[model samples]
Target: MHYRLICFDLDGTLVETAPEILDAVNDTLEQFDLPGVEQSQVERWIGHGTHELLVQALAYASGVEVQAVRAMPRLFAIGQAFDDHYARRCGTRGRLYPSVRETLYELREHGVRLAVVTNKESRYTQRVLSQHGLNTCFDRVVSGDTLPAKKPDPRGIEDCMRAFAVPPGRTLFVGDSSIDAATARRAGVAVWLLPYGYNMGQPIEACAPDRTIPSLASITDTASSSSSS
Candidate 1:
């Protein structure tokens, strides 16, 4: 196989987490007497993590002016509250994407090393993985809070490569956003994208993934062959 390591983005790629995340966000907003965000808008605000999501959600909810929202000292309080709420609610309503488990098992059985690199807090990422019985599939997992930098920064990808002792040319990143593409570009790894994932309200095809597949299972054949080569 041409690739020695495979890394995945968590949120939309492997799991359908929109419902849970949206519920948690809306719950927090309601608690603060703030208006809730629409599901479509919430999809666009995701990928950056909870704090950024809340900031954007609040800005949208308030309609008070983006600059004004940034100036609000209470924004931090809201963010913290949202974090707590999400901690309790995340994964509750989410499920692994179709065929994700089967694909992961196939890749693992084929001797392909796997890892997860997500812009989610480590605790939350672990919680979701554990809930879905996916924690054991990956050789390593890197979360946004695990290091000083996150996706699109390339540091997380570099860390994954170092952890696996895999060269950049032999590593492949599977993700759902432009951030993943940017990280792959910076880290010198090949990237494949899933068409159904969230890409900040933009079309994921525009991110220019090397290959776009409809489901995780679609990569099983490729992964198996690549690992043997």
Candidate 2:
């Protein structure tokens, strides 16, 4: 096999999780009697994980700086409230990006180990995967809470490499944001960015990924080219 493993970012790469995330954030805001945030606002806040998302959203809704919100005595309680709301809302309305399911099967058939590396908490990540019938697609999953550090740190990707016994040279990270690109770079692995994901409202090309594809349907092309090279 040219590449032994293909590690994927969950939100914006394999799945359109913003809807569910938006719902949870808005619901939590409503619970606290704060104004709900818009989907576009939540999209920009994603890729950073749930805690950061909530911090930014709460700040936006309350017209305060993020640090101010963080210093609030109720921040922890609000985070817990978000956890509860997000748990109930996970995968309730999100969807797999086009060609994701088929592409995973194709890659797996060629003996490539697949894994999910996301900033989402493990509990919600697992729940979302199962809800989308994607639990079996990946051989392993590494979430934000899986280790002390998350994306933009290389531990998650490195962990996946170790689990699959694949070296950085033989691994590819597929994702949709600068966070993903930075993670892959820190791990010394190649990365491919998808054009359609969130990416904090920036163009995926701005991340300078090794390659950009419109969808996962073209992943086999990357695999084939790598094998030939």
Candidate 3:
């Protein structure tokens, strides 16, 4: 299918941010005198957004349910600590997925507009993009805080479509989770999933993306002809 606009998810699709995020969550838990979780556990909590990750982390650390953690008087302060730690360490440990840079350049060369639609807040999104020298690759970036609601709502995808003047059929959302698939479905766009991203402990195939690709390099060939339809 030919597509003019290509939207990507941040955490798992484009970059592996689990390490830094996990470390920050652990750091916050330690600050509250709670036990830290395993990295594998934190990986399962990724792709939802920092707030959700922190909530889950707090719940896991304190051996309480998420609701209990939410009701705690120190939840706000703990959340702030997580936020601060993450802000300082966001891009320090993560690296772009293989072939991402090359594929993005190839897509841009083919005149396909690129944008990021992430559940991450804009504050850290910009930092990650700039840190990895990816700030120039995208034509637009829509963060979790940019809209009233996040993925599965389609608002961000719709906003990207409007910003790029692309129709649903001519747009594709590339991500690593069901949230991205749902977002594309609700926005009437095509979705392609990556096999190696965080899908909340489930296989990416369970997300039912239109296609599952091995790597970003594979998209270069498809994206070249994608504008012909």
Candidate 4:
């Protein structure tokens, strides 16, 4: 492996979680007597964590603005309800992307340190990983609330590097959105984006990552590692 450490973004990059996320969002909206949001809307609302996504859904369903939804007197209760709904729906509709396990195993076999830095909160992150039998595949897991700031802040990536004593030059961040690309850039590390993951309905190439490989398997030596970090 050309890189010593590789960090992943959980939602779209590893797990095809939009379906479950949409289900949870709709479940919460229905419980609140508000209209449900579509999966397309939810996909665009992702990458910022569930709280923001919930707020967006509420705003849309209730015919209110995002700020108005946030200012609702029952906002706290609404968040709680969404959390409950999402917790139950964690892995119900999500699955690991193609070759995800194989690529991860190959990377580990080559002695590459793996980590997950996601905007997902800790509880949900744990459940999702565990549900997919991926809990032990990573060396570190950084959720949205794990540190002082989340992605695009560089703290999580920096924290991982510091813990592993790996330099930025030998680190790679793989994600499915511009947020991930920005996070890697802020941390001064190379980034690779996937074409199949959520990107707010935008093109992956628009994120300008170091590489836009077709899938996780594309990075393995046997699969076509034509480029290196």
Candidate maximizing lDDT: 2
Worst 10 residues of 2 by lDDT: 220-229
- For model 3, how does the per-residue alpha-carbon lDDT over 117-200 read when each residue is reduced to its tens digit? 998889888988998899999999999899999998899999999987999988999999988999999999989999888888
Can you write out model 1's per-residue Cα lDDT over 1-229, one digit (the tens) per residue? 5667889999889998888989989999899898888888878877997667777888888787767877898887887887788889976899999999998888888787999999988878998999899999999899999899998889888998998899998899999999889899999999999878889878888999888888888787775565576
TM per prediction: 0.93, 0.97, 0.95, 0.96
lDDT of 4 by residue, 142-196 (tens): 9999998998899999999999999998899999999999999999999999999
* True-structure Cα RMSD, model 2: 1.1
User: Per-residue lDDT for 92-123 in model 2, tens only?
Assistant: 88999999999999999999999999998898
Give the Å shift of residue 175 in candidate 3.
0.2
| Candidate 3 stretches greater than 4 Å from native | 225-229
Candidate models: Cα lDDT each: 0.87, 0.92, 0.87, 0.91
Ranking by lDDT: 2, 4, 3, 1
Number of clashes recorded per candidate: 4, 0, 1, 0
